[model samples]
Target: MKRRLVRKLLFGAAFICLLSTQAFAQDGYRMWLSYDLIENPDKLSEYREMINYVSIPLSSPTLEAAGEELTPGLSGLLGEDIATTNQMQNGTIVVGTPGTSDLIAGLSLDDELNQLGPEGYFIEHRVVDGNHLMIIASNEEIGVLYGVFAFLRQLQTLQDLEGLSLKSSPKVEFRVVNHWDNLDRLVERGYAGLSLWDWGSLPHYEDPRYVDYARINASVGINATAINNVNADPKILTDQFLTKVAALADVFRPYGIQTFLSVSFNSPVDIGGLETADPLNPDVADWWESKVDEIYEKIPDFGGFLVKADSEGQPGPHGYGRTHAEGANMLADALAPHDGIVFWRAFVYDPAQTDRFREAYDEFVPLDGQFADNVILQVKNGPIDFQPREPFSPLFGAMEETNTMIELQVTQEYFGFDLHLAYMGPLFTEALTSDTYAKGEGSTVARVVDGSLFGYEHTGMAGVINPGSDRNWTGHPFVQSSWYSFGRLAWDHTLTAEEIAEEWIQMTYSTDEEFIEPVKEMMMMSRDAGVNYRMPIGLTHLYAQGHHYGPAPWTADLPRPDWTAVYYHKADENGVGFDRTATGSNAVDQYQEPVASRFRDLNRISDDYLLWFHHVSWDYEMNTGRPLWNELVHKYYSGVEQVREMQNLWNRTEGLIGSQRFEEVKSLLEIQERDAIHWRNACILYFQSVNNLPIPNGYEAPDHTLDYYKALEHTKYVPDPWYN
Candidate 1:
């Protein structure tokens, strides 16, 4: 009967509403580094015995931080304080670089240690003089810090430390979180209350949140973060704010998270009192160089500029009829002296009539190999914006000589804000694993961004962070998985969505298989479920204008045609879907070989991408034997059903996980149900008005008239900051 109850609860998400009670409310600022004590007696004892003593340097800031974290982390997990030792003894955990610890230098691990680059680590258990020892050694101090965190993670997840032999390293060079936070504390496209920076109190008041924030990021292998929005403000570079930014840098230095800024391209004109901010202008270049010198003085280890040049209304070299290479190269020259990088954003679109997906490629591919060595073009995962589903950006493999990185959005600006639990792990993995077919069939976007395919030096994966001042960090409990997913993937792109979700589950929630099994399944399916209910099967960017919360398929009122739903959908009386084939925009031609050919042929295209590449008639036959209109409608309904499945599964985990978090997720799931229905009803009805098609017999009818749904009174709703 208990098994039967579990089955019903797991599948149906029954009693989801019961999770909303006050008894379940929790402040979620801890994030994934919850050093909760282990309940398993055997594993706890083994872990305690393995890490009886820690021997690390007392001076190096990075090593000091590693010791601080390890001491508390082991104490919390083992339920006792661990002893430190200078002498090599049994059960001694020696953690340091070769230069710091002579014991580590004499390990004869030269060959094994060489495989781990500057920031990789090697953990091994050895015995000398019958003394059981665990050595966490690395080539650099930062690598030892990472190894220490790995050791703590084992404790957090209750993994046996006995005979632990593990070697790990980040595949990418730079892993950063790009915060779209403004100076006034307003987070653009942010849904979780306010920005986490607390600019008003910063530079003076050292908020403890900054410390924990760094700790959490370091635990996940994230090494850098840009505190400001990519749509930057020139004032951030001013002397006053630079001092403030430096203060935050001092706090993060110990944890190895470098600070970066999103620079306004027109800084010379806005802040330097210059007439023209042209890249070619000597005075403008001098101003940037002088300012970078000031920044480095205030913060020596600064990660350089993240420029959103010529994109949106942001100023760039385009104003002077200069190429993106000319613009990026100018800044790269300035930052090169300081060993800094320029993350030039490739999310560009002009007012001209063209496919939005093709614009970034057209502008960037021509400038390949022209950029300075330090300049890396930061490309979004998809060709289009961060839609529910999109083909990999054509620019990934197209630019061989240029360095590149992937930028993923963790905030659900278009995925239902903080109200829905849409895990983004699957979405991230899907884009990373997409085969670009640039060098060959195996030349994937992951390889392109990781810098292996192009044989380039720099590589990175950035997440537009979702963390805010909300009690739960991200307003929804399950939404935390996206944050975890981004960090884990940025460290190593090879990890599966399911693996990350399961690891996050063990650390973030419960370790019990019962709780983990269903929750892991829910997180894995969340992205697909959201795509189903919102924009499934390559139907991209059809959300309500401005707010982007609900459906607005009929909207064509935006200033730019490309900004509206009608621009991308191109739905009419004939059929629904865009045409990007040779007859259409020829965006498919941007891809190499077999990929382009497969996308061009209707018979060969994946059904998930049919609407993306080709415009089909309503009566056109689908792979599933359904007509185009019927298939589209079926997909929308299938997405809604998937959400219901998520809700039921979430509701059933109430007793297994913490009551407060369980109920919190339950309430979010309830909100998701309504949002999913809104997406389904509004989209189906509006499309029905155009196609004049009947709803399949099994699906539910529209909840209200199209006008009723359209009349959603949106008051001061601005989804994207640039929308205004």
Candidate 2:
């Protein structure tokens, strides 16, 4: 009889969801948090029966928020109102922190909860006196909040609730989202729209999107957010802005997201009216300490500060002849008193006689154990800015004694703004899964950042967020997958790209097999396609100067050679590709043992990284046994074919999803096809001009002249992002 009633309610929810399909179905404002009704009857029946009654008394704002989400998610899935009663009933779902409820404390789950840390939780099915119940217990209120979201995600993603045993702990200690938003509500490299923070009405009027942003992040186990751009302004450090930031802290605190800020390193001089902002100076240190104290007094739970010192023209202690460690440690000392950390970026570069790719490793490796315990060096995924395909930054395992955090760009600044549908999951997976060879063979980049390899004091992974004021959160609808993918991989790096893609697709779009299978294939292949057209065969940093939208392989006019395309491609009369071998930059020597030796050899390395470490002749043989020129031609043309294939595959989703989204994506596919052909033509024509070779037979010919591709104007492009 219980099974019958559960089945009836399960099917009823599906019926209601089908009827309410018009309820804001097209706009993607509600991201992966879309808890649509469960249509699968057998799985839904099991879940409905397991989640009948919920008992989570209001303990704190955090617990109240978690309990508030439970009823709506249950009602939306079961197609009926779930009652919250004082009395326990059959099939009750009890959720609470250990100290808040006697029923949970009696279970004595402290041992299990203690192992998972303060932010982890477990949901188990328990039986007492012939009554079966689902118990969600955690050691802290924040852990209970995470437990609630994880339980709801199972229903949202259509997972079976029978014999449900969910126990999860975030692998990385600090999973943060970094927003490149400015005080003027203008975002750099942001394609979605203007900034989400309304600075004009900030301290008083709060936006609803702020809470929703925290909700989506909490669902994915994200714990912190650096809410401003790293290229910060001194005005943001004033007391006026602290009150404005405190308002956002109030909204995010209940969701377990502690707010952080990007601070100007010269704040002592710029805001505090100091004569010198040297890290070693006593007056400078006192000013910073007082400012940090004031910040914590206003917002006690403030996470910390993210400083992009001495990178891309940002101010730093270098002006006063101080090392990066001295600068970082001084700020770390101030924040350490409040249990706060300082994320000092390792993206510094100069126009010295050195390879730009080897700069970060060179600067930070020697100062391995110099930083304070509370300081984490934030290194980009690649040594360079977020290129399409570059080797993992050698800084990962090089600094064993220093706490390191891997920083990733999810905003598609170089991958092509809203025009391209490139999923960043594969890129993130390739970097994380690469063998660092720090200690031995199994020492992956994941191990270094997760504090397992050298057992560091802190561990973190921060992604530069792609979100803006667009209705879909991210500009392109499919771009949301990258944001979701980053959060999942940060929580647990073992998750595969295929799993993340499937999970995101099932939540964002329809769960129909026909719709899922094809879209998943298209999503997984999107990254390689962009790489082929933009920067294939280990090529990096070949885009136009400012916007980075169009192809400009001939760009040689820039303030610095490292900022130009020719510096990366090295396309001269003799040959192409930068030589980073022992004969050249010797940057490959930074990696440990066999890993470095493998990259140094051409025959042993994969075709994906052939040109990265070595410069070969135009007639050199590749794995296909074809000459280098022939293979280069094929790879460039293959990129266009992939995009065309993606367009045809997307056409299959015409009737599966809403026409508004379907048509919007289809139009972007058209733009992508045009852009891919332009890239193939522009790059091949320029390389052919240098190699003095003809277009290989059976590939599309360039319609425009080489001079025409070079002459296209990109100097006046808007939004020059300070990628510090």
Candidate 3:
């Protein structure tokens, strides 16, 4: 009898060990699709019983990806092994194109599916033969694959499964991420870790990370990605590198993602054996067409090129006395036959121009209607390069006949990198919701890009991805919110920044109210706080030369005249701001008359953008009746105090979350506070020197001398990942 009891006890112990091992195996690498066993197992028992078997027909690459993803997700979430069959069986979850599955055909979904486009899906749960059946149907194989992921996401988020009727499609025609990665596996402005792409082993040995990267992007609505930096390397377009790119395209294809490359405009002369790359020359045009055809042969669904030309020393049509329209149209015509589109960058500025901010609008606005139907002008959120705050780019509504896409920087290049928790959702919303007054008061940047305002054939959005090979993906845990926000906004721009932040916090962190509330508050206020301390009153481009880390208000020795801080702020005894009004740069005239008139009036303009539009004196009275200098001082002090408050708020949540993540976040916040003070002090001191004014009474003096701030250099700083 004793021996029998020992055998039973040993068996029970082994079973418990198996269960524990299974439970602990899940890591968050799957992101929101972590389909772990439901906490309320009873609530999901019906789905477990109904989805015991899956039948998928027409084994295409995309259908295989759906099968590979769904089976594992279901096994983990429901704690049961779901059998796959070639034919429909009782309680089968059928997924495929209309003709591939009888269930889909019987429902007469082919016509409806055809209307949903290549990236759309329809999910329906109905009873067949007295047994419950869930069907994922689409006109194309890739759409079925997307449906499978969407169905799994619903389960992961604990949504209802019965009587489900859902049909979904992307509002924008193209959703892409532009990676500024170099051949050396370094990411430009990347703070996370080393680049995810392993260029050294490409073509010969493809990394599994490439497949994983596609999976993550597909989970969101992102359908296209440009693999290289805008600063093109002609070698990347060569036959040798084409093979490597083909390998990546193959991995991404199953996930419904296409690969794009940044091309050198002078590649015909630099990489090819041709004499010149003039767009109007027959030889040059023939060479480019042949090159594009060659690329398409290797990767059939390859997205077209992204060109950054005539800016920062890159070659362009300007080199051949042709307009940007002629240059982009040449490439666009080549890619048009293959259902591809070219994304030409509009971040151009000439140092010789008196007003750098007005250069892009001046150059491109005249050629608005000249671009090919398949070309899009990808403009930055602001006229300037990702400043803390600036007026919306005038280019948004200026082009009525051309397609446009808003390009946002997801990586925190200017906002303390990965150290400070600066959520960019607010920044994005600020630009999107700004009334351009092009068509009327309600004409927003979001409407302009969504093709609602201009009624263009194509519309899209691109975020400079912050993903790296870091263990946590993005370097700072909180920085992931920017990526999350970008995807959510791309899907539906109407969603508020607060709603997106809360959703991400709940999914990635804890769902408990105590943990969610304060963290959400921190994210909502973080962007404004960074702006207050760094570039309050719309002053910008004041970072140190290379690294762009801390403050450099005294930097004035750069090669170009506009490259220095003094050129932007223009702080002197006369005034302390850029004069873009009618009297100075006349940059405001680029906007529509109503918008220009509003900004031209000092009383009518918002304080956030006051200094950006007008040059105000130090002693001038603000709307608050305080002198301009005093208001600036007050904002800087207020910013430092807010950081301290954030630190305290974080301290209270120590034991509420995991100790490892909590400690990592706490350390980063401390670093941000220190840097905030440095920005406040350095900027205030420099401005005080220029204005010859007294420091506000309550504000603190500089901890170090102005000379000390100027002497500090970053020769050892990391090079931009794209440049590396």
Candidate 4:
């Protein structure tokens, strides 16, 4: 009897050990969708009681995706297996479109749904048979899928679901992610890892990763995706590639996410065998119309084309001496018949132009009202490329006749790559909330992009997505907040940066109040810290050639004069910074009278953006009562100090968060500290070389010479996927 009892006890212990090992193997590839087992038993019990079963009536791909996501999430979170049913049971959660479910149709909710639009959903709790039931209803099946994710999010955030009644809708019509991904699976400016789309195995072997990708995107407010780099390949429009694109579109459709293509402007001539691709030419117009027709046939709900014509060596109507309006309107006309819109990029600049910052404004402001109704001129946040700190683009309110979409880079191209912990939420808010003062005092860039300022029909926001095939989605785990923040801001631009950081922290790391507060502070200060250390006081674009890794303030001899770091900084013994006032580049004159005048006066200009508009003497007195030279030195030193503080804050969190994530962040903070010092040393050393100024009394001098800093090269820097 003793021997039998011993054998049974040993078997039970072995079985329990195997289960523990299985649980440990699950990494965070699922991201916030992980739905890990809830640690709080009382909370788990309550969730299980609230969600006992799920009823999904619709059976489309998106509907199926919703069902698939819900089962795993609920099973993991509630610690119970929640079965799916065709009909609503007592205490059931019914999720479907109004057309398919009687419970949804009979609620007289169609009118409310019309107000909510096709992408919105209504979540309500109804009591039937003395049992409470939750209903997630939408005007379309895809909305139902979004509703499911929304419901799950509320649970994940530990929000009260009892007596829940809410109708949520996207403020913008189109919230899209522009992936600078190439056919070779490389992502341009993508620091995460390889491209998420497995092109080599696509159109045949459907990777499950694609489905998860759509699920996470739908969970946020992202409704559309442009799959290729804006500097596009004409071959993508060929028949063979259409099949591959169609396959991915089908995968995304059920999640309410439409797929868009970035088409090369010369596709008509390059792919259709036309002699010339001029917009006014009849054959060119006909070819585009036919090509769009072919795309729509393959994927009926294809979003549209994202064109980078006449920008950065890409072909456009400028090649034929035609206006940008003519080029965009031609594509707009082709897509108009199918209800598709054209996103014409306003990133034009010429290498030959003396002032690169003035190029886009000069090119597009003149042809503002000539674009077709179905076209949106996509403008980057700043006049120049995605610099760490820049003045708001003059084009935001300049083009009143055309629809505008704010293009933001979620990827940290100029700010620091994945190695540094820079949260871009504050950076995004700075640009969005900046008062352009075009129509009036309250005319902000957010209002311009959301269609409220101009009172135009179409307006939207697009972020260059930072996702890659890395196990953590984004390379640095914390960098995921930038992606999340972009979608949240796109959904509602009014959200404060602090609020977004709090939400991301609670959902991503821990809901524990202790972890949330300090981490939120760290995220809030991160962007400004990066700016101070890397490019303080409005100095811009001093990154090294090609890789853009670190300081290269002395880089003056590149093929294009504008490509050099010195072209922007203009640091010398006399002064530092670009002169964009009336006397110099006159870039500030592009804004309204009040804004331009405010920037014209060096005293009136904010010190943060002082160098962006005006070149000042090294001895100029700043508002801080210190000379410009002293203030600049203080900012650089303070930036490095702030990075050390971030590391200290993270170290205190060692035992408070998950071991794996904590260790990952801890190591990243170390890298960030080292690089922050590198930035401080390199930038200060180079500036001191130009200014011939001594290092301030108390601050430490750089350990190396300016030549030593310049000799450092990153030849092994990974080329953006598209560049390769």
Candidate 5:
């Protein structure tokens, strides 16, 4: 059954009431798209004067979507129903492509439109033939739809529209969201509810929620999405599942989103009954070619494959002694025919390597130029797994000959899951704005992924996001901010984290300064707070085994050496950090000059990454003039305090934001405080045991002993193996 119908039947008339109250209730289901009536009479009057009628001179499905969204959205914000007109009027907001609209064609905007490419758009307030017209013009219908959303955003954020002139084009070509969802409805690392895709009912009963999903993504300029776990199951490629995927593609297509799939590299053997799945094998290549053809027949605008080959246990070309280039090129060849691209993940690691941080760089740097033009190596933001804090991946700018895309995890896999309000805007901007020093000082990671630094053919940014069956999409109300910020930054990297947060706060919640200022500060400080509590002072990977939530600093019983906490921390009597300088792993040398020199120099390095690049003694003096041990304790305690401050900040806005969401956030902040304390106590005690350091003179002693914290079961916070 369709989930929406099931919801209606189960709830009856109460569901209808819920929909009516949604705007005021702040259920979070509407995310930032909620269009509440403007309370300021003057602002509402101005908006009404500017947008009396929405005039779209086109008839395409995309242009129709623009009209559908604009008319109702304006009506809600202006507190009056907006009319649609076929003729040009003084108060009309005209939106369309030049070819579709004679009014747009007559504007002689050929030079301006030429620069917008396919997905770019412009919104201008101009006096055309003595009529004040708000013109939203683009080169294509989808771009017009984007412009419609952009125009609404100005009203939603309460921006002054007196002399508005805005033009935007995505810095990256492919802005995508990758859902690590499985066929059985279980989401890997997903704290939100079940997978959004109801495979059981799909290909027959379409869900209305799918349209909303596409709308939300399109609202933030996300143009593509991969619909399954990268640890792909071969059945997704079969005829039975292709039909279901096609149904989803149809829903996403009208919103300018192309659907991609995560393909198992062993599909030739697992599903096709072949002897081997080697990329070099003729039969294996032919099997992929046939499968590509079959998929195109189902989804003509399919965005192609996202492969996790040769990583973690997924099968790849390595079994046949073929390089990554060989494997990627083989699939790229099949996809290139249909203008599809291959997103080959460069998240590989070898157990034999002394440092896991150097594994991806070592493996892929040599074969950078060999991969096909259609293949993009999707590298993680950090070289290590998504730890709370780590240096930018050395691979970001190292592969000068490759087309690279940054893959950032929006789900809080290593950042306290759904419990902690760890906003990721700062985290994303930190990585993007980091100086790679590849082509000199201005060569940022953002430039590399956006195809400017290396001048590569393909460029993109993919977020590993969680939007599941939960009413709010993501479990924590704040997670929507990360997903929103990621899409905005992916569209244009120049936008600041603070700018996006303020916009999100104004749109999603209340626009009053009492609510916006404090809430924005909390979101901006959230990521740093998470890092301070869990892995402060460049410490990382101290989470419990398998589940990766809560602390387990002494855990060393894992099967692989690299899988244990001891491998990353290297805590001992002498000190408590892994050494990655010349004397140790030499990972700093991987970065270009100046950046390498700064990281290697103890005095020059930021204390934020002191322990990341060098192992310092407990008694060693820090930039704060305190011992390293004292500084460590200070950061851990400060993190818990920050959460408390966040709670206070949120409490001030009570009765300002709707009571429903205010209470929800209030309750989550309490849980977050408890979790923060747990992390602080467990981590500090465990490290103190190794260093034998006393708590700094002014600090309060730990509530529990090291053994007490260690003896606490994993279930004290979250259950092991998220599937349960």
Candidate 6:
């Protein structure tokens, strides 16, 4: 009898969603938080029966946000106005902490709640006064908000709720989004559009998009954000800009996102009017301490500073003959009073170093235990820049005595920007799953950053997510998948990329098996397809010098040798690839044990990293029994073929999704195919010039000469004004 009533209500809700669909077009603005009506009759019946009403006494801001989200979300899904009751009922969905509810307190959930920490929560079916109720219980208000999103996700994905008991917590303590947005409204390496933060209109006019940004982030368990470029302007720390930052903090507070800033290291000299910004100087330390106090007065919960000191012309203690730790520790001391932490980037490189891959590890490993407790060295996933394919950074588990964080680039800076479809879930997971062998074989990069390997005081995972003023947030619709995957994996590293893609597709588009399977498969193949045509088999940094939009393997003239493509892939007459073994630069010595030994050996190393660690001869036979030159041609051609397959798959999924977004993706795939062909032709032609080899029989010849490809101009590239 109960199931019959639920089925009737679900059908009514589906009718309402159908009507709404006709009125609105899919523009991808909702992303993965779309709360469409449930389609499956049995699953809808179960959800409707379980969540008849929501009981959330709005005692705190976070609880209020949870209630506001749950009320409307359930109404849309169940096709009825879910009652907001102050009192519990037979089918009540109670969301609260132990301190906020006497019922939850009396239940004696100390053992479970204690183990979950402050940010963890559990959804359990409870019997109170002989009434079965779904209780979303936690130790804090923020956890209740996370629980609400998780519950909605279950309904959206049509998970069975029979005897459901779900407990979840973030694997990493700080899951942060790092925005390379500058004060002038242009973003560095941003492909979507202009910066999201409208500096000209901020502090007085809060855009509705701010709330939506917080909602999207919180839905995936992201807890923090750094909202400026690492190449920062010192003016952002001025009193006028603090007011603007405080306004944003107010909007993000209820959603459990603490705001952070990317600060210039010379702020003491630039903003505070000091003669020098020396870390050890008493006056400089005092200036920073007072400045931090001023900031706390406006934004009490600020997450602290992200500094890009001593790299890429950014000012640091190096100018004053001081160590990196001294610079970071000084800032850590200033923010310690407010319980804040510092994210000091370890993306340093020197032209003097033989290999850029060894720079960060060499500079940082010696000073491992010197940093303060609140300081976390933010290391990029790969030692070289954000490459399409490269080995994991040797810095991951190297500094066992110091707190560390993994920094990932969600923006498609090196993978064709917003023009191509490249889902970065595979890229992110590949870096995380790498074996560091720090303590033993099981010491993965995920374990190191999560503080499980070394029991570090602080742990984090930061992603350079370049969402901008574009209507869809990210320019390409598929880039949202990488952002979504990053947040989900930060919450639970155990979840696979395939699982995340399936759920994201279901929530953002349709739950139809045909649509979900094909779209998910397309997303899974995107990262590899991008790597193949662009930089297959450990190739790195071969893009055009400034814009990095297209292939430029012949580029060797730059201010610095490390800035040129020839510095990375040394394609000479005899062979291609940079040798990083003991015979060459000895960069493999940075990794521990079996990893170092495996990379040093030609026979033992994986083919994926063959060229990265060794400069092999053109005639050297590969595992496929083909010569090195032939294998390179095969990979470059196959990459173009994979992209064509993606286009076909997307074309087959035409009517399954909304025509607006469907057409947008369809046209973008056409562009990707053209770009893939350009990459294949340019790279293969350039490499052939050195090897003096003919094109294999099966591959198509380049349409244009090598000179034509080199002279081809790319207009409107490089988002940052300074790059231009």
Per-residue lDDT of 1-724 in model 1, one digit per residue for the tens?
A: 3532332243223112212223322346566766667767888778877778888886676887788777766776777778999868998988898899988887888987999999999998899778899889999988999998888777767776667799999989999999998887778888776778877776766666677678789888999999998888899999889989998898788788999999998889988999998899999889989999999999999999999988889888899889999999999999999999999999898979488888999999999999999998999998878888888899989999999999999998878788887889999999999998888889989999998999887899989985778766776666788998899899989999998888888887778878888888888778888888777666878787676778888888678989888887888889878899989999999999899999999899998888899888889999999988787788888877887898778777878756666777787787778778888888888889998889888887877999988896243333444345
Residue-by-residue lDDT tens digits, candidate 3, 194-287: 8777777776665556665776677766889998988888999988889889878977887888899999899999988998989988888888
TM-score head-to-head 5 vs 6, winner? 5
- Where model 2 places Cα greater than 4 Å from the true spot, the runs are 1-23, 713-724
- Local distance difference test, per candidate? 0.83, 0.85, 0.81, 0.82, 0.88, 0.87
Quote each prediction's TM-score: 0.94, 0.95, 0.91, 0.94, 0.97, 0.96
Model 4: per-residue Cα lDDT over 510-628, one tens digit each: 77777877788888888988998999999988888778878788888788989888899888899988899878989888998688998889869999889888778889999999999
Ranking by lDDT: 5, 6, 2, 1, 4, 3
Best by TM-score: 5
Cand. 2 Cα-lDDT:
0.85
| True-vs-predicted CA distance for residue 442, candidate 4, Å | 1.8
lDDT of 2 by residue, 1-724 (tens): 3532433354345334433548664578778766677767877787777667888877777887687677777887777678775445677888887789877877778777877778888988777676677778888888888888888777767876667787888899999999989998778888888888988988676666776788889888899999998999888899999989988897788889999999998988998999899999999999989999999998999999999988888999788899999999999998998999999999999887468989999889999999999999999999889998888999999999999989998998987787789999999999999899989999999999999999989999999985888888888888899999999999999999998999998888877778888899999999999999878887777777778888888888677889888888787766778898889999999989798888899888777887788788888888899888888888889899999889988998889988888999999989888888888888899888899988878876788997887776364233444432
Better model by lDDT, 3 or 4?
Answer: 4
RMSD to the true structure for each prediction, in A, is 7.5, 5.2, 6.6, 6.4, 2.7, 5.1
Instruction: Tally clashing residue pairs in candidate 1.
Output: 5
Total clashes for model 6? 0
Candidate 6 structure quality by residue, lDDT tens digits, 105-143:
767788879878888998888878877788888999999
The better candidate by lDDT, 1 or 3, is 1
Range of the 10 consecutive residues with the lowest summed lDDT in candidate 4: 12-21
Candidate 4, overall lDDT?
A: 0.82
